[model samples]
Target: MIPGMGAVATTFVAGVEAVRKGFATPIGSLTQMGTVRLGRRTESRAPKVNEFVPLAGLNDLVFTGWDIFEDDMYAAASNAGVLERALLDQVKPFLSSIQPRKAVFDHNYVKRLDGPNVKKGKNKMDLVEQVRQDIRDFKKSSGASRLVMIWCGSTETFIEQGPAHQSVKAFEKALTQNDESIAPSMIYAYASLSEGVPFGNGAPNLTVDVPAMHELSRRNEAPICGKDFKTGQTLIKTILAPGFKARLLGLSGWYSTNILGNRDGEVLDDPGSFKTKEESKLGVLEHILQPRLYPELYGNIFHKVRINYYPPRG
Candidate 1:
């Protein structure tokens, strides 16, 4: 299951369907085309990753997610403009049949986005329960034997770990009281972990990173990890920064800017939302370069990231 069925999520689901039907290829997904080596290079034991591991095949996947908009996947994909209409048309019935459930959303966390299809609860804990019920219902209705929840939600306003996030006990209390520090992403993460489902965060939000969430993950035996999906600019940074470090190249400044026009871009137009994404992007160079150890090359290097929302570009 997923949250925020916008461009990224819709494109992914539609592409998977297209690939499953042999109309297109899973170009960017490693699970489809990647290989793994079982032993030494001399052994020549490499096999397709899916074959090497007992991973689920494309036919087993049942796509479902929560979206702020009521549009079905086909309409959402069309609005996204990321895939060709002809291709989407081929899978229209499949896409159209998958409608999004109501989302757990708050205008405060993401100031620029809102929709009528949102869950309403008396408090935070109630919201969590609703989401958990959604998971259960989806499993029963879809006949999914196993499940994972991948958060492709918007970037929430930047928030530091506070008293409410210190422990599972405190988090529960805060949830009962509807603490202001608890964001929607946290609620979703909590709900997924509560259901013993592995949680994967694809956006730059403090969802599964807090101590409380960690405790829940451990207690529930749910695998959880992520602050962001390493795509777009970050993917390039990881590839090139290692090369620069290996060559010991001196860097004065690095400036990165993105022009995105999707729903994500609109949410990030808010300063509060952008702050969360900014920190996620800014940390890449520092961690990659290890400026404290290599002071001469990376220390005091000016790094800036800017995201401009230009809807026409989408």
Candidate 2:
């Protein structure tokens, strides 16, 4: 399922709908058109991934989600700033029909975001129960045998690991005590895991990646992965930085910035949220270079990532 169906999700939905209607091809996705290689390279034995696996067809995917805002999927997708107007227009009707259910949110975690279509509860634990109800309702209404929860929401502020993140039991206790470490993403994760749905995290926030959440995922037998995306400029940095490492060159300091005029940029202006993203982006360097093993060549370097929000004309 696609949560926080803003730009990425909406564009994806519109494109998928367009493809299903035979309007265009599914670009930027390997599974749709990419070929897999087997045996010797000279043998020319590359087969499509679909032919090899018992994967469900694209038509089988039924999208659903909970958004803090009440915008229909089309409107949300339009505002997400990832797709062209003409493309969104093509799938407007399909997008309009998919409205978001009330999301389970707490402003404390995501200070920059606020939504009217959200569940209300006196305590954090109560909010968990409400999310569980939403899951049950969505499943019965859609009649989908399997479900997945993907977090595409704005990044929450940085939260350090605490006792609540130790295990599911301690985590629930933290929920009962309204633990500060327990961010809103954890609530969605807890609910999704409780219902046996696989949760995909697209944000840099410490949602399903934490120990408590990871434990819950294994207990529930669901898969999860993410820490921001290696897309756009970040994806480029990943490639360039690796080349520097291959030649034994040190990156004393590397500066990068994105001039984006969108809700995402506005939300990231807050340092707390930006720091969460910054740290996630920072790991790519040392992880790629193994700086710890080579302290003399690549240690104590500064890596700065910046984003400036701007307003643009229609």
Candidate 3:
């Protein structure tokens, strides 16, 4: 299951269908293509990761997601333009079979994006219940014995952990009170954890990274991981920064900029959403370089991240 069936979600579903049909290989997927070495190096006991462990095959996967727009996966993929028309046509029937459900959304959280397909509820807790119901309904209808939720939602407005996020009790109370700090992503995380479903956050929102969520995850035995997907620029930074630090290189400044016209780019055009992404991106270097330990090499370095919404580029 997923929230926000936008370009990322559509492309993923389409790609998986394409791979399952033998149209392409699952390149770069560790579970599918990676190898693991076991025992002693002299043993030469390297095996495919999937063979080394019992993992779900591509055919075993099912798809469903929530989106503010009501488009089915085929239409959504067509709009995204990430995949070629010819490729999408090959998986058209499979893609067309998957349709997005109404999403729990808030215009205040994502200032630049809104759609007709949104859940209506009296309060935040009500929304959580609605999401829980959606999870249950999907599980029964899809006949998925086991389930996992990955949040592919847009970046919400920047927010810090607050009183409402301190405990499950406080969070539940805040939900009833319709607390502004409780963004839509948090509602989904709370609902998924409550249902004992693993939740993976793919956006830089304060979704699962909270005390209340941590407590719920421990109590329910549901794993949760978050804040963003290190794809593109951040992926490169993670790879390069560690090498630079290992070699004891000094950094002066790093200015990163991106321009795109996808829904992600448009959503990030809003400063509130951009601030959330900025925080996630800026922390990468500090975490790897450890400015406190290497003050001389990293403390005074300047880092700037800029994202421009260029409609023509899409």
Q: For residues 30-77, could you state the per-residue lDDT of candidate 3 as single tens digits?
A: 888999999999999999998989988889999999999989999988
Ranking by lDDT: 3, 1, 2
Question: How high is the lDDT of residue 144 in model 3?
Answer: 91
In model 1, pairs of residues that clash are none
Error of 2 at 15 (Å): 1.7
Q: Estimate each model's TM-score.
A: 0.98, 0.94, 0.98
* Candidate 1 structure quality by residue, lDDT tens digits, 51-109: 88899999999989998889999999899999988999999999999899999999989
Clashing residue pairs found in predicted model 3: none
Once superposed on the true structure, which residue ranges of model 1 sit more than 4 Å away at CA?
none
- What tens digits encode model 2's per-residue C-alpha lDDT throughout 165-275? 888989888888888888888888888898888887787888877788888889889877777765755887889988988898876888888776556776787788888
Candidate 3, poorest ten consecutive residues by summed lDDT = 305-314
RMSD (Å) per prediction: 1.0, 1.7, 1.1
How many clashes in each candidate?
A: 0, 1, 0
Off by over 4 Å in 2: 312-314
